[model samples]
Target: MTDTIIIGAGPYGLSLAAHLKAAGIDHQIIGEPMGAWRHYMPPGMMLRSEAFASSLQAPRSGFTVEDYCRLKGLAYSALGMALPLETFVDYGLWFQANLVGETQQADVLSLRRVDDEFQLLLTDGRALTARKVVIALGLKGFAQTPPPLQGLPARYASHSERYGNLEWASGKDIAIVGGGQSALGLSALLHELGARAHVLMREDLVVWHERPQGGRRLLARLKTPDAGLGRGWRSLFLSECPGLFHRLDPARRRLIMDHSYGASGAWWLHDRVVDKVRISHRTVVNSAAIENERVVLDVLSDGRQERVSADHVIAATGFRTDMRQHAFLSRELAEALSTQGGMPELNSHYETRVSGLYVIGPASAHSFGPVMRFVYGTKHASPTVARHLSGSLKADARQRAPARRPRAAAGASR
Candidate 1:
């Protein structure tokens, strides 16, 4: 049996693996390294977070995104620099090559508790047992679709999370729902790919944030400090003092997280989207139906109802971390854990109610606040989890030793 089994090879999983290995823990890292960024996102896409905040949290400083870019001969400076999605993926590949170099590329079909360990059934027909399991599935099982569009078949409607690129929808008439980065980003990408794409959003206008400038403003720092989350005291607190957020009442923490990062397009995307993609403002999708292999959306705007027809509808509503989406979890094991507010209830160290079964990344947001949902979160989360897990594993070994001692004494008496 291995000391631990990390179920994903994304930023969180890879970072934790480096920590665990450096701490001398026996563990196995599984899944395709950087699979989500490599497959789920389209090529032209850029990360929502700044480049500095988008790297894995390695044990040392050399594995940062800036370091990778410098070594690879890419623009390695400020956040305003246009960093392609491909560049980030290439950086992840580089990070993986140096840390957690070998990975088991199979999927975890199902997971269950066997005695005191987790029995992981893999797609490769291999069964591995581990003293602990870290569910770092990231956004894999969390993509959300609006209930109104649930009835429509895949040919008519789908989520933005379901695509590697929009090339398949080439020359198609598409209607994207929502006003956030995903919606605006996809709309721009689709239009550029020769598709007639339109946006349907309930917001009054499409909003965008100004890019961080090259030089620092000394006066701006007096009012608010810059942090991994962004430039503000609140962002600083959330990124550095996540433990305090975790201690607050769950409701208040939820409120802060919900209000902080309410979706807006990047300034870079504004030039690509404006005058190129049409936006139906203050609009809501009342219902969706598949008619003649097309998506017919009943939309409401300005107290008027209208039918919008498109060859396909993309719901960029984003992901929900509700525990029910964890289908790979065995029923008995899932039922044993506490999921009071759709998200799993985790302890201070990111451990779930089920002992030895830990969760991190977006899955730990409900417990650790918004920081856990971002790549920068790994800076705190990976080292914290690795430290706690190392201690617990040693304790477990000591406990088992007492029982073995009695057996040794019995053999000597014989």
Candidate 2:
């Protein structure tokens, strides 16, 4: 059996695999490299994360986004620069190739515990067993579509995460819900593609992040230090202190999750969306129906209801973590795992209640904090989990090793 198997070869999986490989752990990392960024996100979209914060974590140097840019002779800055989605995806692939090595592209058909080992069935009718499993499946199987927009036919409605290309949406009337980066950014891309995009948000006002200043003096820097999440003390703490976040009362943690990062657009997206895309504040879709083969929305804004029609409705409603949503998990394994607010309850090592089963990436956010939702969190997650797995694997090896027989007195043993 392999020492470990890491599912999902995105930033989280690739990052952790790099650490495990460096430690000489016998393991396999599977799934398409940079799958979500390459297949789910719309082309031409700019990443909300600044250039510096977008690197994949690894124990070795010369593998960060900045390093990749320098090697490619592309212009780069730690702040104030908008990282293109294509560039970030390319960086992830490069990181995988240079550090994590080959990743199995096969899909995991199912995963279940078989006695002491975890059994995984792959797409090619192949079965692999491992002592440990890490689910780093990024944001897959977690797209959250609001109730009113749910159950609509595919022709009339879909989630924003389902789109990797916007060409088909050109010249179409599109209605989007939510006020966050996804909604606003997709609106900007759709508008630029000649689509009439209207954004309906429940918030009375849209929030836009301030452009990152190039340089700040000591006092300003001290007051609001820069971190992977953003430029503020709170952001810094959340970015660097997931352990502390986990130690807080569950209710307080939930409060932070709800209010910490409300819907907002990136600084660069503000110009592209404002005065270009039509956005209605304090508006929400009450119901949706097909009228004349078009999606009709009963939208409520400022306490007044209005009828809205569109060729398609997109829910940029973001994701919700629930371990049960992963279909590959066996019924027995699913029931064996514990959850908190739909998230897998993880320990300090990112292990679940099921021994040898662990979850990382966005799914670990509830246990680790909001940082796990972003690539920068891999800096903490990869090394931390790798250290724990390394020690555990070593102890297992010692137990399996044949004990040496006591040496008999010189020449006494036959």
Give the winner by lDDT.
2
Could you tally the backbone clashes for each prediction? 0, 0
lDDT of each: 0.87, 0.91
Can you list the residue pairs that collide in candidate 1? none
Go through the candidates in order and give the C-alpha RMSD of each one to the true structure: 2.6, 1.4
Predicted structure 1: lDDT: 0.87
Clashing pairs in 2: none
- lDDT digits (tens) for residues 229-333 of candidate 2: 899999999999998888888888888888877799999998899999999999988999999989999988879989999999999999998778889999988
TM-score for every candidate vs. truth? 0.95, 0.97
Once fitted onto the true fold, the runs of candidate 1 whose alpha carbons sit more than 4 angstroms away are 403-414
For residues 1-414, what per-residue lDDT tens digits would candidate 1 score against the true structure? 999999999999999999998889999999999898889899899787887788889888798889988887877765776668898888888888887779999998899998899999999999999999998888887888889999687888889886796798899999999899999999988999999999999889877888876467788875777777777898899988878889999889878878877778987898999999999999999998888878889999767999999999999998888766778789887776637745888888989889999988988887887888789899888998999999999999998885544346555754
TM-score of 2: 0.97
